[model samples]
Target chain A: MKHRTFFWFFLPTGLAMFLFIALPIVSVVTQSVFAPHEAVLKTVENCTPLVGCTTETTIDQEATREIREAQPLGRFVGLDIYLDRGHLAIAELGEAWDTAETWGDFWDRLFNLPLYRALAFTLTFTFIVTPMLIVVGLMIALAVNSLHRHLKGLMIFFSLLPMIVTPLIGSLILFWMVDSRGIIGSALVGLAGDPNFSLKASTGLTWVMLIVYGIWHSAPFAFVVFYAGLQTLPKDQIEAAQIDGATRWQQIKYVVVPHLMPLVTFVALIQLMDNFRVFEPVVGFNASAHATSLSWIIFNDLGGETRQLSAASATSVLTIIGVAILLSPVLVRTWRDFKGK
Target chain B: MASKAQRRPLGLSILIYGFVGLWFILAAFPFFWTLWGSFKVELDFFSIANWTNAITGERTKATYDSAFTGAAYHGAWVQEEFWRNVINTFMVCFFVVLTSLTIGTLGGYALSRSGYRYTFWLLITALIFRAMPPITLVAGYLLPFFEWNVWGILPTTIIVLVAINQPFTLWMLHSFFQNIPKELDESAKVDGCTQFQAFRHVIVPVMWPGVITTGLFSFLLAYNDFAVTAMLLSESNRTMVPAIAAFLGTTYTEGNVMFAVAAVVSATAPLFILVMFFQRQIVSGLTAGAVKG
Candidate 1:
């Protein structure tokens, strides 16, 4: 294809991405370094008859409005927002480090910061969910592969339901089921023999609930991909392994898994990216009091009466950085593959 | 393939069946349970007195004189005017899929045909964009959209979603186009057809399988999205997912949790139909990227 034709063909999609995806990234970075304008204050002196002369400082609303109108991007604070307590919290980190008596104490203080707390949960969720889902998915694929032909289709159709449903709605369904008065919650109460044993009341149980939801939601995606990979498996390799007197487990370990290794990597890469953005489940589970993710933090900031754009932008920038880091391995491998080709 | 040596033992077969059955229940029970519960009143659905009330709808029978009721659905769809949000969701999904596929096919075709290093970089850029959570972009959009008075509207949200949908769409279609032996279009060009003509006449004729697969995914992305729609749309123009979320906030306080339950079930019904029809396309589309890699 000629450069001109290629240009024309690619122009619409490219322009859309540039304006929405590329430009917003730049906008987010810029907004992160800037803070919304502070209220303009003025002092007024009131002299009462033989009583007192008082000077009161009040917000000059008119001046503040004019300044904000003039510069809607707000004033540039140059990383002040990034370093503030709501974000990186450099000063708080230093205080925690200096005043802490032990490593556990120091760790507790670090987790108290909003950004670090969110980072901890996001990373924990990502790392935990990705591997567990892959295992569960592989198990389901193998089990389904061994089923009769008529049952395979039915199993797959049912399997896709959890993944195909909207993330928030799926989580909500699980959330309601696990409510204190709901079936699962009442069953747990019976098991524990404690009427007041609520899953939502404890941080540990809430985290477990979210992680279980994550696996339940995403495992089907893995199963579908692996099931497809299983369809293309070579018969000769498995037969050869069988002829060598290999057991079922050994045949799978040596022949099946090696063949599906690339697919495993592919599933891992996709799931990593998907899991890192774990926001909706947090919202649906209403687990923000016990657990928060980076995406959830940004959502919380952007919401409500405040609409704290600067804080949200800072967190957005940080989240992007986290994604870039998480993605570096895949990006490097892709670059290598392209160069080799 | 199921020869004597490959046959599973009775014990193993039983184990596999047990595991798969358990999984089947785990994967599907919640939706059916929620669907069943959505028809009952709040007390029976979340019964503190007796758990069996959820199944039998004891309180529901006492109040509505029926084991099942459409009262919740009526409350959600009529009293809350959730139909407006449902209409908005379909409108957004329709435009987002249409625009995404239209532009994506062209760009994807261009990338597949052009033998240049820049094509590689463009895809990589798209991969990066795809990885960034859409909420991160919301912060950037709020200031500008509010300033321009374009925030909280369906059209703006549609365009944003289409843009977000581009990267994955391009990658999917790009790979799909590559599989369509270049000879088809090249032969057309040899017969005096222009490049555009070749694409329009030859390539387009055979591209429906790929295009339909890609379109299914685009529709899913636009339909399943909560972040962009929830933030970008106004109260009057809210989509079903966000509307349900909003329902939780109001209905909980009003002791009308059944409204939210019905709304959730209603919102999920379309997705259930979608999966029922397009299961094959969805599975193939999912494996398309992984298999190629």
Candidate 2:
């Protein structure tokens, strides 16, 4: 294709992306540095009357509005919002480190900061769920691969449900079942012989539930990918291994796993990006008290009347950085491939 | 090979089937359970007094003079005007899919055909955009939309969704176009077709399978999104997912959690239907990216 034709073809999408995706990113960074204008206050004193006079301060609403309108992005606070306790919390970290008697104590204090708390959960969820879903998904793919042909589609149909349903709805379905009086919770109570047991009450249990939900929700994706990989497996190689008197497990250990390694990495890369923005499950489970993610923190900040745009924007910038770091490997690979070409 | 495969142990087969069956139940039973529970009264659904009430629908029988009731559905769909949100959702999805696909096909085709370094950078840029959480972009959009007084409208939300959706759409369609063999358009051009004419006449017809697959995914993203719709829309213009989220806030106080339950089921039913019909396209769409990457 001619370069001119290519330019015309790419123009619409390129423009849309630039306007919405690229522009919004720039806007988010700009918004992060600026805080909303504070209301102007004025003090008045009257001494003309012979009696003693008192002064009163009041917000000059018109002046405040004017300033806010004149500078709609709000006051430029430079890196202040990002450095505040709700975000990077440099000062609080310093204070905690200076005063703490032990490293554990210092770390505990650090994690109590809002951004750190969110980051901790987000990282834990991402690291744990990506590997876990990959393993479970691989097992499922192997099992299903062993199935008869007619049954495969039926199994896939069932498997896709958890993945296909809206995330919030999926989590809510599980949440209802895991409620204290619901079937699973009731069954757990029976097994433990503790009528008061509830999955919602404890942080550890809630984390387990969310992680389980994460795996259940995403494992199907890994399964489908691995299943596709399994289809094109080298039959000749497998037969060679078998003819060499290798055991079934040995054949799989050496031949199958190595073949599936690329698919595993593919699943891992996609899952990492998807899981890092974990927000819906937290909302569905209503487990925000026990667990919070970066996306959830931004959502919480943006939810109410105050709007907290600067706070949300700060978190947004930090999240973009996290995504970029996670994605650097893939980006580098693309670059190398382009250069090679 | 068949003889050797048949020599595998019977117990192993049984174990594999057993595990697979267990997984199927784990994967599928939640929707069935929720659907069943959605029909019963709140007491029977939750079953504080007796777990068997959930299955028996004993409370539902007493309350509605039948073992099953659509009262929850009625309450959600009629009383709460959840249908409007449902309508809003479809409207948004319809346009989002249309706009995203129209531009995405063009851009993706161009990228596939081009041999320039910029194509690589553009694809990488789209990848980075795809990786960013939609909520992060929401923070950026909030101020500008508010300033322009364009916040809380369906058109704005739809445009935002299409833009957020463009990166994935481009990547998928680009890959799809790559698989089509460049000789197709080349032959068309040799036969005296202009580039655009070749695309319109030859490439477009052959592109349906891949495009449809991509379109299904685009539909899913637009339909399944919560963060963008929830944040970008207002109370009156909310879509079904966000509307359900709103229901959670009010229904608990009203002792009508069943309304939210009904809304969830309503929201899920379409997706269930979608899978039943388009499972092949959906599966192909999902694996295409992974396999290619």
Local distance difference test scores for all models = 0.94, 0.93
CA RMSD, predictions in order: 0.9, 1.4
Which digits, one per residue and each the tens of the lDDT, describe model 1 over residues B97-151? 8999999999999999999889999999999999999999999999899989999
Superposition error at A266 for model 2 (Å)? 0.9
- For the candidates in turn, chain A alone yields TM-scores of 0.98, 0.97
lDDT of 1 by residue, A187-223 (tens): 9999999999999999899999999999999999999
Which residue pairs in model 1 clash with each other?
A: none
Give me the runs in candidate 1 sitting further than 4 Å from their true place. none
lDDT of 1: 0.94
lDDT of 2 by residue, A1-341 (tens): 78899999999999999999999999999999999998999998756676888887999989999998898888989999999999999999999989999999998898799999999999999999999999999989999998989999999999999999999999999998998878898888888899899999998899999999999999999999999989989899988888888888888899999999988988999999999999999999999999999999999999988899999999999999999999999888877877786
> Comparing to the true complex, what docking class would candidate 2 get?
high
